[model samples]
Target chain A: MIKFSNVQLGYGGRPVLNALNFEIQKGDFFGIVGPNGAGKTTLLKAILGLLKPVKGEISFLNIKRGHKKRIGYVPQHASVDEIFPIKVLDMVLMGRYAKMGILKRPKKRDYTIAEEMLKNVGMEGMAEQNYRELSGGQKQRTLIARAMVGEPDTLILDEPVEGMDIQGEIAIMELIKNLHTEFTLTVILVSHDLNIMANYVKTLSIIHNNTLKLGPVDSILNEETMAKVYGAEVKIINISGQKVIISKIK
Target chain B: MNDFLINLEFFKYSIACLVLMALVCSFLSVYIVLKRIVFVSVAVTQISAAGIAIAFIAGLNPTLISLLFTFLGVAIFSIRFTERRLSNESRIGIAFVVSSAAAILLVSKSARGIHEIDDLLYGNILAATPFQIYLMIGIIACIFIVHFLFYKEFTAVTLDFEMARTSGIKARFWELMLYLTIGAAISIGMRTSGNLLITTFLIIPAANGLLIANRMKNVFIIAMTVGIISALTGFYLSYYFDLPTSPCIVATLFLILCLTLPFRFFYRKS
Candidate 1:
């Protein structure tokens, strides 16, 4: 688990997210939701240790001394180098680099694990295919496989299916939901839409105006919180026991 | 016919040096192309050229002067600024333009060194001394050895930098190491093989390899193969047809790049 006590995250002495106090429990499928430029990424970056806090510090609760918690990070596939010549399996195997020694290469067991991950992600058939030619959904699956291959305690995905089609989005999100259940892994997902994440995540942290409200997804998905987060008049509807937000800025 | 080739003994040494330089530059070229830092190479070369010119003006050793300038250039290029006001491309472009001007102006100040500067761009491969040859072998061997030892780390950083950092791979150290090697290679490569041939070897071969192979390992193999082939064929063509060596090498590389199109076309279809 990770804890943040009065943490203020920022860049260049300018605070973006202020007065954050929260803890992500072990094996929790957590979602951080916000609109564009709402310091959501700043919070994620701080948690990832990519950005230092301006005020308070983040401390680990259950982590061991002198050893950092291993995190498997899956960035937006669009942000990756597009022109590199890499196969799907090769892309996934990059996750094992940190686990092996500096001079060590991936061995048979590593390949076996990588191939198993690819199979779990439903990409076993395309392991030899060029990564550049993959569809958005397949690429997302490959990226997920890449993240999972390292066998990290925590998996962090940043907009994993932002550019995918509707079916692809559902499939990837379901895959993530199933993985969280099957592996008993701590999953932290970042997205701009609360409704898209509401059905999958157990807990939600809604960031707005450099402020955050964290609670169970059911409590946080109500109209009042959605309006405050969006700065708009909003309505919440129940579709198959799932909360969906309808907002109008006007 | 064999006697004629044997008589061209000094020519063989030049060819060996060219092939070795090509092999070394081609190794880093894959990273350079994949990282999309082609402009960084251009900027480094120009900054190094300016250093050579400045050394000539100051009566200093050109290799040492240029190596220092190349290191400075690498450091500047590797810095990640918190501010986003000026894009990185703009900064590199500014450095390139300024260095180019400085190289011309500094060399103009030392009129006698102008011919030597021309030799720097076009190279004097046939005139390489024994000391230069030995120095090149040492540097080239070290480059190959370092890459062999740290290739996994380098490939990890190049493939996905943020992922590497998240995995606690010391991405910045690897990045700096990668740039340092590239800087050293450019400075030394330009001196012996000329900037024209060095730039060609640094970019075209990797690109050509990527056209035919989807696997990174295969791409690297093909890149080195392309470089060696061009070096040998270009050297022979220069000897037989009485053409310029540097331009002949560059032309051959470009020709091979063009020739790889069929492979790409077929690969796409397959």
Candidate 2:
């Protein structure tokens, strides 16, 4: 569980998102949706401690500050170089590095966990495969496995299915959904895909107008909020009790 | 072969120094190439060379001077550039050009003049003494131990800097450590192996290994192997053909890299 108290996030004194107040309950599959430059990634960076908040405090209910090992993060796939010569298992083994401590090599147990994580992600067959050779979907899954292999209390995924095909997106979303229940994980996902975010997430936060609107997906993802946030004519259709968002051309 | 045996005693120290320097540089090359900081090595080498030239002009110890200058450059370069106008690459490029120009000017003004510059650029490995060999071994051993102890941290930082930071690893600290190690290696390596030879050793073997190897461990092993093989064979060729040891070794490394191209192609296809 995490609480942000009047948090103001920015870079170089330029505030991107201001006066943010939110509390992420444990085991909640919380989704943060917003337009480009909405400071969603910045919020994630603030939570990850990579960027300091310009103002306010971020308090972890169960974990202390500087003890971020309990939170696993799957960064945007584009952030990593594909040509890097790392094997699948080695990339996954990197997850256990925090627990392995300094000067100590990974033990047999660590390797076993890494292998198990690969299996969970349906990448056990490719453990010895070069990571660069992996398809985009496989790469995303491998990254997810890497994040989950650490066995963290919280999992944060940024654009997990950004460049994937529709099938790839569905598979990844299903995988995350299953893993969320199976592991009882506190999932925090950031994405621009409002449709998937609307259907999957229980609670969603829309960063718009330099502030956050937090509520259930249905309330937060209506046409009015979507138009206000995205500056586009959008329609929210209820299909079989699931919310489907479609942007209309001007 | 008989000629090499006849001059075995003379060649022994230089051979040991080259092999050790090659091993160390090859190991660090993985990080350099993987992190895409090959230019940083070039800039650091140039800075170290300039430091040595300045020391030569001032009649001070060139090794210590070079190390200090290299560390200074590393510290400055490691700081994250806040100004968006000047990219890190542009900064490094400026550093490299200025250091190279300074080295040339300083060497031209020194007593030994251009010949000293040549020696700095293409080192005289045949001139290595047992004391220098011992120093190489000691320094390389320290670097190896440090890398071995912090292998995971180094790999994590090189693989994903932000991920490492989010996982509670001090990415900046490790990055500084990486730059320091590279600085120390370039400083010492450039002295014994010269700038051209050491830079080739720092880059080529790692590139060759990464071309053919899929795994990180294999890449390291293949790189070290390439380095050792190049040094030994190059030493023999230099002895038999009456060539400069540094250039001969670098040429051998280039040849080996070329030879691995087909294998890389085949491996990728498969």
The window of 10 residues in a row where model 2 chain A has the poorest summed lDDT is A62-71
In candidate 1, how many Å is residue B102 off?
2.0
Q: Please provide, for model 2 over A1-250, each residue's C-alpha lDDT reduced to its tens digit, 9 standing for 90 to 100.
A: 8999999988767789999899999999999988888889888888787878889999889776666548899987778887688888888888889888888888999999999988888887898887888898999999999998889888999999899898999999999998899999999999989878988998999998899999987778788888888889998888889777788987
Candidates in order, interface RMSD in Å: 1.1, 1.4
Please compute DockQ, using alpha carbons, for every candidate against the native two-chain complex. Answer: 0.74, 0.67
Which residue pairs collide, candidate 2? none
The lDDT of each candidate is: 0.85, 0.88
Q: Give the TM-score of candidate 2.
A: 0.94
Which 10 consecutive positions of candidate 1 chain B have the poorest summed lDDT? B1-10
**B1-270: candidate 1 lDDT, tens digit per residue:** 464487577576687788788888898899999988999988888898888788878989777888899999999998877665778999999999999888877777676657776776777788766677687788888888888999889988888888898888999889988998998888776666876788888899999988888788888999999999999888888877888888998899999998899878987888
Instruction: Work out the TM-score per prediction.
Output: 0.94, 0.94
Question: Once superposed on the true structure, which residue ranges of model 2 sit more than 4 Å away at CA?
Answer: A64-69, B236-243
**lDDT for A6 (candidate 2):** 97
